[model samples]
Target: MEPSKSSDDKQVAPPRRVSFKYRSGPAALRCLSDGLVYFAKPSEFNDCLEAKFDHSSVADYIERMDRSIRSVSEQRSCAGGYAVPEGDLASFEAKTACDDVNFLEATQRVGIYSTASRPDNQPMWTYYSDNSKGFCFELEWPDTVLGRYQIAPVGVLYSSAARVHNRADIFDTLIREEAELHPDWSMDQILEETRSEFFRFRFQMLNTCRAVSIKHSDWSHEHEVRFVTPRAGPLPIMGQILKRVYFVRTDFPEWGPVMMLLHQLYPTVELAKMSFQHVEPYVRVQGMTKKLVPVHE
Candidate 1:
């Protein structure tokens, strides 16, 4: 009735722990997330999926599961922010009038409006990073135009999801290419170069933009969506630049399994569970609302 020595030894062995460390650069993180298991990173996502499902019919199951998850609306009002008033004829008309007058172009327009009307006291820069040395891009959707939106720089962190094949080479290529593009450079050359490429690519993507709008009778909403492209065209060059310094994760097949694990690890991680299957991999989450809300607490 006594247990064998082999069984006793097996029972005494410790269970392996899955540990993930944060990377310093964006490209490094992207590589790690893209199924490259170097440096103690999790790799072999397909194997992980197989282990989880215990079946070969992962494709069909995934397709069905994705559809179901996508069906669930992740829309919620941004935290500490009021919904921009809708259906107010007077306020709508006033905003239209203000926009029509090119008020933003005038030097004293915001000041003039502040004196004449109540200013919106909402914190405009919720996720500003002083280190980034640039501003986040804000895209405002127009209610009248089903899927129309305007893109503008807000404070200092722009949201994007771009994939790159190689990190170091790409970064070097971009720096050299940008430098050649702008010969007259000085101390602020690096900052200007990066920003120029970012905006240029962004506009290119915008030009070929296709709107991914969602609508519901329960809650109606629509917004324009586009990838931030490189100025050189729909090429990977700009994507590399963005991936190097910015926080972005490339769309990879392995991402599905990795995300599934992350979801299981933290069930209350909102929007983190949502997979960008066929569409652009990047979807901006409101900075204030990304905090994990505990299900039990």
Candidate 2:
């Protein structure tokens, strides 16, 4: 009744412990009452149905869930500490909340918003390093938009699932609105346009940040989500600037399964590594340096 060994009969190392700070002791974290994914059973989604979702029921369910989330919302998280997509929304041109915007419009608006708001200069920063155990992008926010914004990192159980749910909620509402905007397009056309990950990533990156703070990166935030472009030293795998992002912070584990999850989430795009574990600063002394330069933390 024992486990197997490696090819060399050597012990394999267990995965590194995720660096997220521990919270209150175990009491099963309530999510959909029993770890449901996206507020409904997985079986609830069907691509072929005439009307796949019960919009009203889902809204009611989300309301109840929102109330519950608010109760625990004050808890801290790995969030980079900025205004996130879900929070910074102003009234879209459509004005009408739901069933007035479609996938294309939704994607296009964020694009416009992000491009319009980008700042000329951003603060230079290395990697994730914070004495308080928080990992946030350092940026020079314009005086008009800069302000103290706190964040609540997401819980482990709901990190990935919540994103799907959250994004889906935004998408579905837009789809319903699209029903209004594109009165002539068939559901098949609608579904096909919205299903591609390209649009999803385009829309996603456009979101995640209200104010642009990174120098060369596409996304930005004091605490929400920002990344470094390959020009600013992002991994080479991430393609052309503004299209693919390298790193971001959320209310979830930094070094946990998120790295893997992100890889799967955006197949073509590259995600910069952000480990949950604290990284020590490398030592460099004046004696060790031969050139004229200054290095400080």
Best-fitting candidate, measured by lDDT? 2
Candidate 2, number of clashes: 14
Model 1 misses residue 73 by how many Å?
49
Residue 84 in model 2: shift from native, Å? 29
Query: Tens digits of per-residue lDDT for model 2 on 126-166?
Result: 22222212222112222222112111111111111112223
> Given candidate 2, what's the lDDT at residue 104?
23
* Candidate 1 lDDT score relative to the true structure: 0.26
lDDT of each structure?
Answer: 0.26, 0.27
lDDT by residue (98-153, candidate 1, tens digit) is: 54243212211111000001011111111121222212222122232212212211
For candidate 2, the per-residue lDDT at 87 reads 41
The predictions' CA RMSDs to the true structure, in order, are 27.2, 22.8
| Stretches of candidate 1 exceeding 4 Å from the true structure | 1-221, 231-260, 263-297
